[model samples]
Target: MTDHTPSSRSAARATRPVRTKALSALVHGICLSLLVGTVAPAWAQFKASPAVSPRIPGNRSLSTELKIEGMQATTDYILAVVNQEPITHTDVDKRVARITDTAPAGSRLPPPEELRQQVLDALIDEKVQISHAKTIGMDISDQELDASIENIAAQNQMTLEDLRNRMQSDGLDFQRYRNSLREQMLLQRLRDREVNSRIQITEDELTTFMKEDPAAQAEVALNVAHILIAVPEKATQVQVAALLSKAQAIQERAAQGANFAQLAKDNSADTKTKDQGGALGLRPASRLPELFVATTTKLKVGQVAPVVRSNAGFHIIKLIERENSAQATYTQQRARHILLRTSPQQPAREQIDRMNDIRKQIVGGQTSFAQMARQYSEDGSGARGGDLGWAAPGQFVPEFEKALTALQPGQISEPVVSRYGVHLIQLIERREVQLTEQQQREAARSVLRERRFEPTYEEWARELRAAAWIEMRDAP
Candidate 1:
């Protein structure tokens, strides 16, 4: 994690963009796919280790093992400390360089020393979060971490050897990058448990906000999906020409109403997202990359955009759903489902067969869904007859959402496989509501959630740091 900058990269090879996952961190690991939110391309699940181990899941315990192994009394400078953990000048310098390297070109950046302080603050916050997550016994297994790396490689259209060689050539220590990755996943897991789980919005608050807030009521949301035809760096003229042709073909197929998700799964370079058909989740335009925002401006729901090129490569985009708050209205589905979880004992096929029979029982009027769900559903909703309640778009994951969209009221769907398990879905009824009470609450709940997330998390960070024994060492 020394002051290694991609701008000064030594690698002659360019990494391809994998538009797999989205977050506000360094993503893509390439020049082409850079966007406002860092494009995350890996997911590792590993057991937590020492303070240093949480940074990266690799076996190299550099923080503890290498700190003094080859040290000199005068060369290594102390920068800061949190508890007994030390931060070296090298740490500060690396972060400063990373920030500088990743900043948008032509944007005015602060002095390196000033950026050092900000980076230091961020590191301290990260250290506190990692410490907390470790204390709580959250760990990602090495196998899981390897899977993340594999996905990263796969998404970039490279093998693990290729990725390692690229990193080495770029003057980045591969082991150090893994450590950075580990810290990232650890922090994300902590937030999911501590911060994300606690925030809640009340029904009363939603009703009040909907009635009173005019401007807030008019915000728009777009549900977009994309396919990346990634072009590797330093591609030959012929290579670029072929990629353009491929992108054009994909775009043409999309416009002619080919199954976009299937196309994405079959052809998308970003494997992390191919399974979900490149679903980016539901988000506002403000949260999206400007390129996407502009591309979708004239597009309609269920419509496809022309092949759009960026630094990364060409994109075949689809506008899955969109909403205008000013004229906000949605058809809410009152639905319930019975889940037959795929376990070692039952397996996926058995679960599917069982679910089919359950659907038949309900459809054939042998028994009510609620009774069946109450008797057999493995999830909490079983007690309520699998009543998931009313949901607008984005309430459920994409697989479930897509299924729900297809069902007419009182019609049952074939067993659908989601991450949760196999489900037999029945849409009880559907109604179009204009700022309905339930709609307002759900929206306000989400709005309030977004409002509380950042500041609350910051406050939480400060609290953790406060509780730690941190000391600032004079920079030499």
Candidate 2:
């Protein structure tokens, strides 16, 4: 995903609500558990390493022979051993190279030695976790591993062959890459099994949590769209005036019932969201900028806010949707889908084409959506004509929720691919309803569980590390 950080040109560029890194990483085919401080390299969170010129040597693992795109081959030797598994110097080097290469622009780097130590520690943790997983008989089936690779390819909008070729071109060995993914999968499953099971929130604890953090109980989520008219840093007063006038005109058009999305597509200076009709998606008030939340808080759905000036530019804001816990109300969506799970025999593209054909039949009136769904959908809901029932926000995965949210009531979505499978979704309807006491408590519990997860996982990992047999070796 492109960094949403503001550029030197404008702070408005950074005004887009931040998405959770896990979801973003998943969408981009990076391992999700890596974002949550799992065994994988914490590249995004860690500082980069200084450049190093590696010397090629005879003693190297087959995996280390595949050098990263701009990095030279390095001598490989044992750096550490965990449960009889060797963590090599090349292993640490490759991770450091990746971190250096992909670290966000303008990020600082730690001393080379310090960064290497961090990478080595992460590798040791991974080896320990993988060993534990094997000891516990936790293994990824071949079919499951294949499915994961296929999902990654699909998420990247590539065929399996394309993904393979891309990896090869980037100096990555296909088998080694597969092995790495398998290890990540094992580590994630192990953490979920060992860590998630340990977290228990009682009813009284939930009540206390909600009472202490009332804002959590009465959270407000907003879906806001904006059209930005950027003013350059060195702009004269005349230039600023011109941009402000342009913003005001756009705001007027939006207020008078012009299509905000269309206006955004035509004129919004914010590149990241303009393509998506300027919507930043539904996010908590805390996630959005203070100025934006404050501006749109009082606006009814579909209402527009007046032109506002900021350091970045002039903005024309529109309220798309709002869910307020204070009002004890939230929007619920009733959607149905025709799902076709992908397999090695059935490629994602073929399944997608099949779904498209099904969509065509439904849209052409040759068959009803429900009829097609009942006849062909592979999901459990197929028997019920693909009905998913009424669901509130976050009831579905991120990709599914995004597709569902984009559809108007009674409108059918184009085939959407999620981790589950390809889906042909139709939004039946949406309603705003009051939250029941039971639902409120459940929500509180959910929040508390998430809050507790990181600390619990860290403690669990520390215990595992302490118990593992580890030995440090001299660098050759």
Best by lDDT, which number? 2
Model 1 ranges with Cα > 4 A deviation: 1-76, 170-172, 221-323, 326-440
| Candidate 1 structure, TM-score to reference | 0.47
lDDT for model 1, on a 0 to 1 scale? 0.61
Off by over 4 Å in 2: 1-44, 47-72, 220-282, 285-324
Q: Scored by CA lDDT, what does every candidate get?
A: 0.61, 0.68
* Lowest lDDT 10-residue stretch of candidate 2: 55-64
Error of 1 at 466 (Å): 0.5
- In model 1, the Cα lDDT at residue 220 comes to 63
Give model 2's TM-score versus the native structure.
0.67
Clash pairs, candidate 2, are none
